[model samples]
Target: MIDIVTVDTPHPYPPRISAFTRPFWEALAEGRLLTTRSVATRALTFPPKPISPADWTTEVEWVELSGSGVLYSHTTIHAAPTAFVGDLPYRVAIIDLDEGIRLATRHIGEIAPVIGAPVDLVAVRHTDAVSFAARSRA
Candidate 1:
């Protein structure tokens, strides 16, 4: 089982919400994964866009991801952004989701993660925004 850490300090920089990204934020708020896929090419894209990157078509739709992925890479950050200064030595990981899309998210486990290890999505709420973390799949 994976553990979730709780910090008293909140994130300094909250996420900026806009119409284009509203659906994503809503899904994250509900602890679910939301992404976009091209109707023509069926290519998936993160940060959901109106137009498909694979094909220059405006045909896209919102799709729910499984939230299960493999930890492709990760890094420990002693130096962090102003908002994340309080949380030093935090782990940021790049996860390759089962949907075939890669998401760079925070790792929310006690120990360092292994490359190619399975990970699952965990929604973390701060004072200002909701962020996603990758935890051990097991």
Candidate 2:
């Protein structure tokens, strides 16, 4: 049986919004992946840039992203964030998606985090969401 850590109580953070990140936040609310596209060169970018960093063009556009990725790096956190009190000692990781974007998020599920492990994005909830789980190797 796989081990599961249950959070009895979870602290909350007041949601904050920013102009460049609005689309991403909104998409997450609707269970959709959101990324940015460079306006000048029409290149795809993650973390949603308002302008193309390469050429300083304001042609950044929002795009949907597939959530498949692989674990790049990870750590077990003993101290939780102030807003995540009950979830102390959680596993956090940097997942490198197939599109070559790397995102930092809490890693979940039964197995321990490992470098180069296959992972997939699963929406846990609206607020507490978007985590990666180690893919089972048969």
lDDT of each model, Cα atoms only? Answer: 0.80, 0.65
User: TM-score per candidate, in order?
Assistant: 0.88, 0.75
- Weakest 10 consecutive residues of candidate 1 by summed lDDT: 1-10
lDDT of 1: 0.80
In angstroms, give how far residue 14 of model 1 lies from its true place.
Answer: 1.3
What would the per-residue lDDT of candidate 2 be over residues 13-73, giving only the tens digit for each residue?
Answer: 5346687787776665555677888866777776678777767888677877777778889
Residue 110 Cα positional deviation in candidate 1, in Å, after optimal superposition = 1.7
lDDT by residue (1-138, candidate 1, tens digit) is 112334455656667878988998887877777888899888999878988889978989998888888999998899987767877878999999887888798888665699998888877777657767888755
Residue 60 in candidate 1, Cα distance off native in Å: 0.8
lDDT of 2: 0.65
